[model samples]
Target chain A: MLLNKIIREKINSKLMLTFTILSCLLVVLIFFGLYYKSSPLFTNNSIKDLLFSSEWFPLKGKFGLLPFISSTIWVTLISVIIAIPFSLLTAIYLTEYADKRFVRMINPLIDILAGLPSVIFGIWGVIMIVPFIKNHIAPALGISSGGYCLLAGGIVLAVMILPVIIHVVSEVFRAIPQDLKNASLSLGATQWQTIKYVVIRKSMPGIIAAIVLGLSRAFGETLAVLMVVGNVVKMPHSVFDPAYPLPALIANNYGEMLSIPLYDSALMFSALILFVIVLIFNVISRIILVRIERSLGIG
Target chain B: MDKRKIEESIFKILMRVATLSIVISLAVILISIIYKAIPVMNWGMISQTPQGGFYLGENGGVLNAILGSLYLATGATILALMLSFPIVFYINIYAKKGSWFVHTVRLCFDILWGIPSIVYGAFGFSIMILLGMRTSLFAGIIVIALVILPIIVRALDEVVRMIPQGLLDASYSLGATKTQTSVKIVTRQALPGLITAILIAFGRGIGDAAAVLFTTGYTDNVPTSLFDSAATLPLAIFFQLGSPVEAVQNRAFASALILTIIILSISILARYFSGKYNKFKV
Candidate 1:
């Protein structure tokens, strides 16, 4: 019986280890798979021209991704700029100032927002934000826009990522020992002073990691941004200008990629770019998060 | 001292405003969708498939998309569970504490969790091209399974990690092998979390649009087989909203309402069951 049990145990462990290794290898496979599919584009055009040039005409084989890349950057940057302050303040409020019952009430609301489908957000953007911008905000600012522009995409994305940022940042805040807050309080520091000097200082790395993760998420969002951001293939000089983000480009054009020469390859290349960028951001944030957890003795 | 007090009050108001804004946005989104959908939402909306000229504001419902999403999410959840259970079990039960392999696997999962679904869509499309396969429910299931695999594994791993080591030790002292102990003790302890994880993954799978957009070609009819094209609710909303007709746009809001209800209920169920089941855990 002992021998039989030992054999079974060995077999089970080996089987599970195999699955674990395979799962890890799957990520690498995705990278290589995307690269292989996009390799054809590299042969005909240099990476510099493909990424730098602004012209994009599939019929004549001119695929410049600068407009898409720039639009993605502008939209993501705008979202981060708008979202960081609001989310940070919200996190601070929930963690430091709010009562337990209040926080509990808000938590579920945040969960609902986070669980909401991106398509719903897209619809909400179309019906609400687009018209509000076109009819109200644009004219007030002495500018004219058709409602579908980079600003609309940024606003939609900011709302979408708010819950994510708040969740991470508040968790970090909660992880701080109560004794540390008490120590600051005992030093005659007001709540805001303690938060400004101690809580924010201690959680800076975590806050940054949360923002990076949020930015990564904003970069990859497709349908919502696709719906609001006018899919115009040009550089966006201002927030009210139309833009086509990288994920939107892939989502919009992949269905019709088969008719033109190397169209599939170009779209695949854009997907590859998104994949790499998200991977890098995720890795950077993971490193920071792990380090913070280790320093806090919670890992 | 007075200046510091004033500064504190000012910052407090700012934080309150920030929190209120987020809550207000959630309310706005929910209310707007509900308001727009109420007029169009009827028994027929959920009961029948699209008829001819349905996109042109003719009589029909999103029954095809509703059924397709159900079938797709269900299949993807099952597949993801199969794949995730083994990996999560290996990481928590079989691997040594702080093992390099465990660290690497966890890191990979974290990265996978962050990858955008659109990239997954493109990747799935490439896989289809390689296999010479057409867009079908099967392809969508495969792609969504990949999308949710990390979610299930990470959630399950978090629960499994919290299982008391003493429980496993006691089982081992009783001559229980690691396999026996894991299959019985660890799984039982993690059951609540596992269920919650599954529900969460299902919600994500069903609500997702980008990953399945290219993999599952939308159809007006409900798919009878895995090889048939499937129209998901998210895509239905997208396609319907794209129409310039008022009726078609209203249908999009109604579809969005249905999807929201499904997702919200799943999340609530996950939380409720997890709390109720936690009492059974030692």
Candidate 2:
């Protein structure tokens, strides 16, 4: 027993370190994998060469991530722009105006919506929505191929992200102390005005956090966009035009890559860009949350 | 009063329209999916192998996939739990000095939760390719579990943390061994959290399609072993979307509805149990 105890005592630190290293390595490996796959695309000097060279031709050995980066931002902006108002308004109604009973009723329903798997949304978009758009909505919009257009994907994505945005924003709104709401109303601000100015302002960090989370979520979604967004290589012009996003590009080609070096590297490059974007969003959200926590004086 | 009331009425109507549209869409989606998905619910659809292409349809029953998802997720969750519980327990209980490391891990895990499944999928794809199991269920489960470990740890920590420090003080004063106190007393307090954590992971795994898709490509047969390739409900939806036939699309809808229900039920159950625990404690 003494010998066994001694052995455990000696090796315990080793065990702990192993687990810690594994966790840290998982995070590190994601970055390393990106660099390893995308090494062929290095164009110039350290910072400017890696990020700003403005040329991404993996096949031709020119690596330009700017266009893909810009396209992603565009899609994210479009989805968020459509989602924010609806979500904010919904949060307002749920938290500020609705009765507790009514709020309880709506809350779980929205929670369920948030929990709907992305693949299901992909199926719905592909089987029903895209075709519906192509046959009905597209004719009205005057788009060419109704299948993979940006508008269709954006709208589906907006709906997929709606429940998340509303649920998070509502929770943030609900967290605001009741006195704040009462304080606004006491100053002759109407209920709507109170919600708009006081409650909303107090919840801005959380609301922004929610939006950034949504952007991250939208940025990484694969199946929904893959099935609906036409995997066109060229940059997309309008929401009406068809274009591929980063994750979709990775999913479509990763499994069946006949073109060895370039295709695989391109997929990895997009993955790298995505990893960088998500990492930035995460860090920013953490810093903002810490600031909010400090300002609130309670966590 | 007349003109202002008239404008207020218009705004109210507009708000009502917008709210109703959201509600209507929600209902319409459920109804459309359920109605379409009803025909695909036969047991035979699962029991058999992919056979005569339903008019140039993909071959194979999803039997292997169902078993594969179950075992792989189970295995991964078990691995995650074993790794997390002891380490998190030590940090939370004994190694107070290592709080920073623990907290940093917790933070990364939280960041991990916010990450959409595709990044995890890419991570799995990378690891799996190295293991030479490019389209395997083990890869799928590892991705799912990695994505969910933080959730389990957080929930377990919350449950344990809420156990009054008084209990630990009492046990130690009574000369109880730390191991005895942890196994018998500390983890008992955390049982609810552990269950909640498992359910949370299950719920997340059940809903996650992206990570599993790349790691475990769409195989119709449910996997009987951990090492085999297979599909799950999430992947089924993605796979069926590209099918040329309407019947297959309907099957996807039905599968989607089933998947949503499973996710929804677990979430609802978690809420109920957690709420009950709160009330019981109060």
Candidate 3:
């Protein structure tokens, strides 16, 4: 028994040490990748011009990324604006109003939706959303449409993120104590009133985390946004105007790296920016979510 | 009282409408893809590889892409499992639960999970350039494994965490070592969850295009070696859609149909297995 115990301890210690090293390696790889890949842009190009300037003519040695940055912010903001109200309502319906069978049915459906690929979303965006915008929304508003623009990308992103936001929000709502709702109901409050006052207020922190997560997803979304955003390197004047986000720019321009001197570096720098922003968002949301779960006193 | 009742009914209607929209959106996507893909999908499209001018709407199939995706996803899932299983097992068994080190590691994995797939592609591209390596099947496998590591680790961690503390104590009281308990007891308990995690990760890897965009350069030929450049279904659809030819565009829909069928089947199988496993749980 003693001999077996000592052998197990030895193996356990060795395996644990190895895994710890692997964890460290993951952090090193990400930081090193960003630093090493974007070095050319920092060394050769002026950081001020690369960030502040809006002109992005790679062949002419101009590598401005302001257009992509603003466009990313715009599309993400638009998507959040489009998704939040709908997600809130759906979450409320699921938690407060839906029957058990309905909840069970929709839960798996949501999982399947979540598992659907970004490419599938892109195809749907291209075939359905884009043409609908061009033929209906644009013409109604007296604007010429190419069927691919910020609006189309934003709408596609909104749909893709809806499942996530709904899932998170519903969980948060469900986490609120049953007694709270019963108390409100016993006081003559209606279902909506109880939910609006008790459920939504108590779950604010988790809902914020969910919104932040959705924003991060929208900001990082690639294939669907790339297909619909028109890949134009310009500041969009309106939702109907074509524009490029940072991910789309990196994806669309990476193939043409051989034609320009520092184009690859520029794209890498854009990717680094994306990585930093997404990492920050994820860390913030996770912290908030943990706090909320702790406060709920659930394991 | 009357005003409150009116407001409640109105809000209920709005909520129902919002909920219905979600179902409608999913239905529209599935229906439209099937409508367009069915006409172009056939045995020849599935069984044969692309011939000359496949992108130009000539006679050919996406066999190369299907096979390539299977190879890359399987390779990446296996590699990710090898890396993730040890890390997860260490955290759950070796380290003290709720310790600062374990928390930090979990946080790190969460951040890794959130990093954009495009960033992985860029990082992989740079690594390839620094090593003077061309895009190949191996590169895609590595990057996709990196992309899914957090997923597998977190998922398996959740499963391992569910192992009853009493069981571990029982094993220890029986004079069994920690390694024996972990390997014999914990692993047996986590087997079903581990399989589900692996399947979901494989699905994510197979469907991803961004992380493999630069790593796996497109080719119509099925890759026979790790170093060979290979095509994937997502990129295949992307390239096909880019062509102006009408027939080529239909092929893109057909490709999406095939990819969807693969993912849906995996999902259904996973659900079935998980259900079956639940029946056996202690």
Candidate 4:
């Protein structure tokens, strides 16, 4: 009976360790799997041309990723720009100023927004933002557009990521010791002065980490951006011009991958780019977050 | 002093405006979807599979997509939970405190969680080709399981980490082995959180379209076997909206409404169970 109990315990522990190792191995597997699949495209085209040139002719063997990359940057930039102030302000309000009842009421709304699928956001973008831009905003700016442009993609993405940023930033704010705020207040600092000088200064790293996470999310968003961002393969001169982001390129063209010689490889290469970029962003933010947690003595 | 007072009031108003706008946007999305969906939503929409030329806006239902989503999400959630539970157990119970291995494992999960589902779809497709398998329900499940594995593990890990050290010491003082303690004590303590994590992952898996796009070949009929192609609600909405026909587009709204309802209920259920189980926790 004693031997059987020991053996069972030993087997259970070993089994758990094996599963943990496999979970860690998955990350490495994804990285190399994408690299191996995309390696074929490098044999045909130089890395510079693949990334820099704007020409994307799968039949002619010319695949330039500049247009897609530029569009992604523009859209992500627009989203971060729009989402940062709004999310930060909202987070500050909820954490610092709002009473318990107000916070409680707002929390579920934020949860619902976060829980909504990307596809639903896509449909909303197509229905509301697209027409609103096509008829009002574009014409107001003296630009003619079909409404499916970088701006539309950016606005939709901003809304989608707002809940994410708000959640993180609010948590960061909540982590600030009430003593710190009280110290400033007792020193005759106004409420705004206390937040501006003490809370914001202390949580700067956490805030930046939250924004980076939101940026990473925006980078890889596929369906919603794919829907509103006109899938035109060209360099966009302005937010009103239609452009295709990298994820959109991959999602749109994967079905026809078998038709071209190196098409599958090219699409895989885009996925790799997205993978690498998101990984770097995540790592950077993780380091920042970890440092903050360590300093705060909370994990 | 006067300038500071002005700034304080101005910023306060700005923050309130921002909060109000966000709440308004949420209301807008829910209202618009419900408004558009109400016209076309009916018993047949959820009860029967597509008839002839459903994509062209003919008579039919999204029964195939609904069933497919349920099957795919259910399978993936189960697979992910099997892996995640063990990983979380090992990290919390077996691993050394603040060890580098634990930290590395956590970093890996975080990175995996950050990766977009589209990349997972691409990777899953490549794996399918390499394994000599076709796009089918099995492929979709595997990919989605990968997508949600990190989400489940991280969530459960957070909850398990909160389990008080005294609780574990008490079990050990009673002469229980680590495995036994983990299985009996830790499991019971974290049961509410575990369920919430599982449900949240399920909601995400079912709502995701990109990860399953290339892996699950869509069909109008419900899948009868693991190897059979499956249709999902998100993909159904996508394909239907692509059609130029207005009726097809309306059906897309109906599909979105159904997806939203399922997701919202899961979240509400998660909240309810978590609150209910709070009384049991120390």
Best by DockQ: 1
lDDT of 1 by residue, B1-282 (tens): 699999999999999999999999999999999999998998888999999888889899999999999999999999999988889888887889888778889999999999999999999999999999999999999999999999999999999999888998999899888888888998899999999999999999999999999999899999999999999999999999989998998999999999999999999999998998999998
Model 3 CA deviation exceeding 4 Å by range: none
User: What digit string (tens of lDDT, one per residue) describes model 3 on residues A24-66?
Assistant: 4675687678777778777756888888889888888788999
C-alpha lDDT score of every prediction, in listed order = 0.93, 0.69, 0.88, 0.94
**Which segments of model 1 are wrong by more than 4 Å?**
none
Off by over 4 Å in 4: none
Q: Per-residue alpha-carbon lDDT of model 2 for A58-129, expressed as tens digits?
A: 556555555555556666777788787777777776666568897777777776676676776776676567
All candidates: interface RMSD: 0.8, 3.4, 1.5, 0.8
Off by over 4 Å in 2: A1-21, A43-68, A142-147, B1-22, B39-41, B58-60, B95-103, B131-134, B176-182, B218-220, B275-282
- Writing each residue's lDDT as its tens digit, candidate 4 over B1-282 gives 699999999999999999999999988988888999999998889998999988788899999999999999999999999998889999899899789889889998999999999999999999998998988999999999999999999999999999999999999999899998998999999998998999999999999999999999899999999999999999999999898999999999999999989999999998898889978998
Tell me which residue pairs clash in candidate 1: none
- In order of lDDT, best first, we have 4, 1, 3, 2
**Alpha-carbon shift of residue B170 in model 4 (angstroms):** 0.8
Instruction: Put down candidate 3 lDDT per residue, B1-282, tens digits, no spaces.
Output: 699899999999999999889888888989989998998998878898999888788999999999999999999999988888778877888888888888788888988888889899988999899899999999999999999988898889989898889999999999877778878998889888888898899999999999889999999899999999999999999989988999999999999999999999988888877777876666
Query: What TM-score number comes out for model 3?
Result: 0.97
Better of 3 and 4 by DockQ: 4
